[model samples]
Target: MTADSSLLAQAREWHVLLHSGRATAADRAAASAWRCTSPAHEQAAMDVERLWALLGQLGEQPASEPAAAQVRPLRRRRSLRWAVPLASAALLVLALWLPQGAWMSWNADFATAPGEIRSVELEDGSILTLNGATALDWTISEGRREIRLYRGEADFQVAKDSTRPFFVEAGPARIRVTGTRFDVDYDGQDVVLAVTQGQVQASDAQAQPLLVGASQQVRWSGERLQPLQALDARQQLAWQRGKLVFRAQPLSEVFTELERSQRQRVIFLDQSVRDLKVTGVFAHDDPQAVLRAIESNLPVRLVRLPGLLLVSRS
Candidate 1:
């Protein structure tokens, strides 16, 4: 039987926590109780265990070696009372080393690692600046310059070519421009376009084309495009200079951007804190400092884990 996506995710989380080498007796008990809540939950957990066994057998090193290395520093006390099987911990190690965008990185002609920004000059003289964890493929034919942004954000400085139009396909949004400077941020769910110079035509499958000029921005989602809104292009595109600027955004959204620069996952233990508003100008180079600043200003505390950070109410 196919397991529900939400239940599968929960099962994965439980497996990670149990094998993290920090699982307490209480944690194991809680997991057992969770499994007993529903038969579907138990089946999901069993599926995860089977997946772990396959990964362990296919892994190059012993199943426990990687997990031991990762959690050694965090292991202040031994949890001898609750022992996890070697195969069960293999998935935790894999999760630590591989990101969700691994497939995108493999398929992209140009891709940037976490916390890495890259600039490439096309043969057509256009400049493309990729943000951290970004991936895209480009095709420059005699008649057109096309870019497929698989994930993340990018800034484009299109070279004027009257005979060849520039096109960017990101998720459900389609952008067209002949010669212009613009930034496109695709986070899988939404595509946001910001024009710094010249004009850009933004559209989706079911919406009319919208013309966005310099200092304007538009968002495309769910087969619809939002009306253009005025923005300071310079401030919005400060990420090119290793800076991040946010204006009254939610804490969860801020953390999403921070993850691109920090190369770490952020988990909110208290859901209420996700909606807290955040506004600041932070240097992307020092994500820890940025997190500290947020903690000082907001009513939240940061907990560092093996490969992720947890946020909780102060």
Candidate 2:
């Protein structure tokens, strides 16, 4: 590991020890030495502090469980001495996994990092949950609540608006609602909609109206409105609830969903993997864990590039 990476590892281990309640006298001494090592040490600790701030914002329990700090019992055994270094190396890599996107709440806008869950309350007391890698422009003015989801998915629990309906515009389609909960997902070609609480009337800027009821979904593939069957409330809105449920979904599509929650971008290395069917219920964060689950269920191999994630047939 580089110097920066090494310091980060130490900083993460220190915090883990502090939180785990297993921090011994030796762990405290090591932290003291690390803090005074150099300015880089301070910087790494500050980085960890920043991460914790964003991580604790949405809820007390983080969706991604942090790595534990290394605390080897001071046994006089020599075999475990080698194990200590191995443990440190593993924890160091875990620190680098922290994504910067989770800090979006600290900004004027609201966003989630890869493997983060973000919840924001609007001016009208409604709640909005933004999935990882999702981007949306939200501005409430005069008598209108408008949001433009540029990409990814967002679930909105809209406050009441009679004259000025709560509106979400994704691509060419716009959904108009008044005091309800709904989800909007904008992919490249198709704009998807799912209503959770109240009724939603969706219409393209240049197309006919598509009415969707609670517990229902409708998709517009740029040409016509396709009404989908009624389904469970979790089918489309599960991500906000920290669950990802797939039913015979292709690996390519699963990778797209996983990209939102992973620090590393997962790219399919072969066309066969793209068409491979996958089904599971994975938590919204710690997407790497989801990949391990996939590997256990399917015939695949995962390769780590310098800054990318590649998946292929075994």
Candidate 3:
């Protein structure tokens, strides 16, 4: 194997060992020493770790029978100690090489690539405006209409269809409405529902249904649904117009939202800097310029690199 490929393989091994909850002090020290060997080593480790997280969010499954059968041989042949290493390596390789469109096409009825927004018209007269990096599917049958928000955000303008109640399932929560305009944003963990017109009822795993009126928002996670808060729904949905508005939010969250607005990944190298609050209006057309503006105001430094943007405390 090439030197770079060898480094990536070693990085994957280190990643699995460290996260296995069985790493000894010596193992950690060895991993640290290996990372210090070269910048390439450190980058490889970081890339693999991030890719693992991304795959988890994208619902990565176990290896297929053929792939599993390949590992079975390493167990039988004691001399070939490549199973564990190859497993993690294979996952990282798939993450790196898999066509993102294929992954989305397999599951999502409709999806938008990173930095791309789209609009869809349901079988009913309802309209959906998907935000960047969003994926959703809908089922309409037997006087029932349901939409599932698998990732990212979307704004819905429901058609007045009282016969078939409209529902949106996001994460661990559900929003039920009949002919109402609202926005749903699922960030893998929490689902935020913002109503622009009319009202909707929201419920999560641990909470009863709650009513949310126009210009109000509610957040739901696996735990419970939060009480409604008043906010400008139009401002929240400004991403539809290539703009983003953050009101005294954490720098980390700002960067996270910025990632959804663009194609590249953003990494916060300094956790302490992330807690810094930021409030600004950013145009999504130029993410790099937005980062530059952030760096000018905050006590953080930004490093622009291909495929990754690194943030650290100044």
Candidate that would win on TM-score: 1
Candidate 2 C-alpha error for residue 206, in Å: 3.6
Clashing pairs in 2: 102-113, 115-261
- Model 3's lDDT to the true fold? 0.76
Sequence-dependent TM-score of model 2? 0.64
lDDT of 2 by residue, 1-314 (tens): 11354566677778878778898889888888888888888877877665555444422322332335223543334345445444433433343454323333444355655666678898888888877777677888877888877667888888887977788888777788888988887764678888878788888766677778887888878645676658466657778677888888888878878777765556454557788888888777657677888889888998653224657789
| Candidate 3 vs. true structure, TM-score | 0.67
Q: Choose the strongest candidate by lDDT.
A: 1
lDDT order of candidates, top first: 1, 3, 2
What is the clash count of model 3?
0
What local lDDT does model 3 show for residue 284?
A: 73
Q: How well does each candidate superpose onto the true structure, as a TM-score?
A: 0.69, 0.64, 0.67
Candidate 2 Cα deviation (angstroms), residue 60: 50
Model 3: residues with Cα > 4 Å off, grouped in runs: 1-105
Alpha-carbon RMSD, candidate 1: 15.7
- Write one digit per residue (lDDT tens) for candidate 1, span 1-314: 53554676788899989999999999999999999999999987886776566556544343243554657653443333123433334544454445545677887899987788899999999999999889999999889999999889999999999899999999998999999999999887888899989999998988888899998999886757888899666566778877888889899988888877865667565789999998888887877777878888999988653444668899
Give the worst 10-residue stretch by lDDT in candidate 3: 93-102
Instruction: List the global CA lDDT of all models.
Output: 0.80, 0.70, 0.76
